[model samples]
Target: MSLDGHTAVPPESSIPPMPGFPPRAGIPTQHAAPPGGTPGFDVTGWVSAKRHRTPPAIFSLGPEPRPSDPKTLADDAIPGWKLILRAALNFLVALEIFMWLTGGALVWALGFVWPALIKAAGQEEFWATTLLNLLYVPVALILVFVFGRMGRWKAVWRRYGSPAWSRLRGVAVPTAGPVRGPVEPVDVWGPLRVVADPGTLALLDAETAQGLVGDVDHQRLLGALERVRQEPERLAALLGAVREHGAVACAHPSGARDLPGRSLAHDLLSRQLRLGAAENVPKNPAGYRGADIALDPLLLGTSLLAVGPAGSGKTTRLTRPVAEALCLQALTGSAVVVVVGAADADLGPAAWYDVVVAPGDPQAGYGLDLFGGAAHADEAAARLADALLPDELALRTESARLALQQIVGPFESGYGRLPGVRELVLLLRGEEQAWAGLLAAVRGSGMLDRHQHELAQRERMHGLADDPGTLLADRLALLDRPVFAGCFNPSAGDRAPLPLFALRALDHPLRVRIALPDHSHPEAARILARLAVGQFLHAAASRADRSLFAGLVVDDASAAVDTHAVRGLQRLRAANAGAVLGLRTLVDLPESLRAPLFGAVGGRMAFPGLAPWDGKLFEEAWGTVWVDERDVTRSLDTSGGVVRRSFRGMRALLEGERAQTESVTTRKVERRRWSASDLAQVLPRGHAVVSLTSVDGTQVPPLLVRLP
Candidate 1:
């Protein structure tokens, strides 16, 4: 099957423009807001396209506004029919009044002049009647303008004319002067010519294009173009494959356009993926409501924290679209994305990813390297220990890591490679012969301390009840089950083993999906998730190239979140990397980590049905914004003679409100952007409250969003 789960055709017959994958019904396709219009408003969509510009291509983001178009004005101040009705009503009223004022005089004058006009013209009544009918047209028009609101046409056109026309055209049209020229072509190199479409070409500067073509490191250049299309992000790999196979030519396996997956919007030009629409709520900025709520690397680079109860659409609404966008960006040669979730989670189709690491599944395409492909045994041990040790064993973690290092280091030194899970577990168990063999190997390899004191110390610890090696062995044995026999064994199987360490030196965009076996092995899955997180952090920080955006999306990050992962998240922004972590609630984590995790991520989202405590984290993270506070006071009017008071009481009884003095006060004061209660209870189903911070320091205050 193709990357998008479509049936894959043979390479020879795959080059065809296929129909778009039919999306599930009732899910609205997202479109860019017509220039000068709100997100959901598109006059062009409502009108005839034949009279305007051509319909946009499937991947195009429709048209943008021109210089002459009114930027702040939207189309049609009033409905066209309503405007006409108003104008016609005014004309009829004016005509009735005119007749009323003229009364019998107008009729008398016309009757008196009828014969005189006929005699002067020397024509029949029919001819005279025709002449009068012709004169009425201009007179009626004059009356309509004088009395009717028909003059509003000028003002309406003045405000909405340019935008309405531009939206209809699908391209900006100049109000004055000759039409704009066609987009210039970029002169680039031969290799890049294969995939550069006209629109993509137009975006390229000649000098930059030339520079990129001449770049000695084609792989590096490919990485730089991630998120922006030049050629398929896999061009370098394709070239290498062709050279290795000595093939004369190769056709695109998946055709020009990416195979369709589930997504509401993919606006590559703006680098934003629309998730939903910002609801028109009081908490949201007036301008933001009805505008597309989207995600891009800029906002995602600071990391995103999503909290929602089960079935709140965290997976369906947020993770799916975000992962799809990153996958599409990866296709453009612009970004690398790693998506983690339960095996059955509908993150995306396996065909969309470069590697699908489904642990516990025998047929999984890739095996996860337990050591994260680390060359240093100590580095591998630290990462593995983090995954193996539970939060309750925080104090035991250091000793466990040390215990793992002792075994892993000696095994690597003796065998010249990292040990698989079973091998590490066997060493950790301190079996008589296994321990003796490892000690002999270490001594033979000269890895032992002078006088063999280190080996002696290890021996002494292994016989004690408090030895951390036993605990470490028990934890590592979780994955040694028959179900995971071939998994995490990079050197044992013919299957490809994916290592997070390779992410640091990537030349082209790589998409990886790690499906944790959540059902059958929940604990093991969490360990794997923690392993992935720890390695991803190390790789992102050590990356040699920062041009391509690196992203991770964890569909359920409950037990996977720990202190180390939180710290890693805080550093992702500076590394040009980010993560999207979804959680059921803050209570899933340790109470102490909740506030710190909130502080670590720059973006936070609270979905409908969130717990109050989870909502509180979002509330604190968003802080407060200034709003106008209004106060009104009413005092009874009771100062007069007895008869006056009785008269006021009678008036109050009749009016339903007592006569009173009123005082009003308005002041600016601080208020939480979104109170905890609002986030928990007031949020509507299929909606979420989200706040975002871009890498460049732009902040989008918390706003309620209606999911697409």
Candidate 2:
């Protein structure tokens, strides 16, 4: 037996026994043996012997079956005459009903007022009324006919339009058996049938010739095939005739002489041929790794992540891709590429990137340098006190002056007073030398120390004056452009609050990359992450319509970040900004940041990680298919060799694998890579993975680069 045109023989066990066969006590009974034979027959051995004895050969079924003409099949299936009659009947019935209603109402009213009408008709007024009433019949009849035709037309079109549209649209439909019209139209007969004229056949053949062989008029072709299937011999003859005519037409040069109607069939056939050829044509150009590596022009418009370990060639990947994108954009005159780095030393030369941002560069000033200013301010204040008060009377100065002296003591111990202090005092006192007397009195009275102390305390307390000069310089720099500020330490202390510069520079979306060491101090990293996220959110809120002035790249992010910063990052996305984060282990991700960041990122790129936990985290964060265990294994190989040498002998062993006495086999285990790539292609160093959160979702990939 065959199923769907394929051989399908049943297994021996599936074959049923004969109806009259008796059951055996122990042995399983399959088919009943031929008369008088043993009940249990060994068919397998027989089959095997036959298989060994015979060689398989390709079998040819006869020539392909010819198909019936599509026109004849359609004519046989459709009840054309019945459809026309139904339409005409519907029209008459509707007209009759309309006439009855209007004519009946008019007659009813006339009956009651006939005497009055007759009296009025003797005059001209009644005649006008009669004329108007008579006009209603024809108008009513017209409306009925129009409405009835529309209703029937809708129904008829619905039935025919589906197949016609599918055919025109090139959609495939199944062909099972002979086509048939509506069952209700069984008694109906068709009137429209034309004789098989050469001209008619030529026209149809020409049209069929125009279309490519595989370019089916889906519904029409399916219907035609179905009809032909019902009568094989008739279909075969029709196809043979069509083929013969087509060959003759092709062979005769004179046949191509443009016969007006005859060309239609050829045109259609030609179209079908072209469409078929097109369908078979390959769309993609040929290439190998180069093709795979070629950057998509579309991807240039989107953000990318290049990630690997320190020495894993992340920089190479990023530089080339980014440079390519920038070059492409420049060539196309589309957009400018701006790269902001922590410092000029970090990013290298300006020529390295389209728009390079380095620390201290005026064009990339993010905000005031809090620490730099504090150091400068301490020096200036100390110099001022040293010049105003004499050393001999310094102890006797006022409480405020003494306090100021103590504040300046640290600066004096660190760096000696500046010579400009005397010049400054002279300016304040309005005398070159006479001011020395006032200074002496104030120093002896302790007032100078007291004043200085108070001023120093105030500067430190305000955080602005401690490094006023540096602060001024940084703020002045920030006024120029956006900066990628790096806060090495983030805490509540004076230096800890340095991220405020990022908050201030939010107006200018600068790209900020923060690197934190992976050690015991996770809390510090968490705090910094929160600060970065908050700064981004604040910026996004301020510039709702513009792209975020800055983004945060936190390497080795911890759960602590989600505690406060994740909320901010989410808000930034809502406002149309972008944020990319990095994490080493998903096992440690804070739930709050995990869900939102993972959910919102537009794309995800995952690298090999330690266990199912990593995969699960990504799956939970972003709906991605779990990579095959084998593929993951192939992608991540971190095992290393250890060699030990002794006086007697030397031995080498592979890490993470145990040797057995008889054989070697490894226990299946989740693999992990030290580093991974993010969507943006920014590689992280050490045993780090890059996680990016954009308007899309979070992606974590193992770094392919080596760690420092």
Please report the candidate that would top TM-score against the real structure. Answer: 1
Give model 2's TM-score versus the native structure: 0.26
Q: Write the per-residue lDDT of candidate 2 for residues 1-708, one digit (tens) a residue.
A: 111111111222222211111122211112211111111222111111211100100001101112333333333344655544555565665667667756566545555767566346446596756765676767676765565443343444544665587557642321111111212212000110122333424533443334321111211222233334456664444334333432121110011111111110111111100000000001111111001111222222112332223343333233322333332222111212233222311222332222222232334423222221123444334322322232232343243233334334433332333212222222222342523433454466555654555434534433333333222223223222222223221211222212223233332212223332223333333333333344444444455334222333333334224433444544554454444344444546544345555543433334332344444544444333322242222222224444322311211111111322233344444332321223223322232232222233322222121211
Candidate 1 regions exceeding 4 Å error are 1-257, 262-264, 373-375, 450-453, 490-507, 632-664
List clashing residue pairs in candidate 1.
Answer: 3-351, 3-352, 53-169, 226-333, 226-334, 227-334
| C-alpha local distance difference test of each model | 0.64, 0.31
| Candidate 2, position 332, lDDT | 17
Per-residue lDDT tens digits of candidate 1, residues 1-708? Answer: 132322222333322211112212211112111111012222212121221111111112322212222222222335666555554555566687566534544434565767565454345577765675565567566665655433344445544675587557645421111122233333323334455443333322332333221111222233333423444534444344333321111211122124243343755434567667765456776646545567888889999999999999999899988898887676555677888999999998876776678888877756677776254778888988988988888778888888887777777776677787767777777788777877777778887664265456666787589998888888888887878755675433434443323333332355778899999999899888888887887778667667668888999998789888999898889989999999998888988888899888988999999888777777778889898897989999889999999988855543335889889999999999888898888889988888888887877778787887
lDDT over C-alpha atoms for residue 96 of model 2:
71
Instruction: Give model 2 RMSD, 1 decimal.
Output: 39.5
Model 1 TM-score, all chains together: 0.67
Q: lDDT for model 1, on a 0 to 1 scale?
A: 0.64
lDDT of 2 at 451: 51
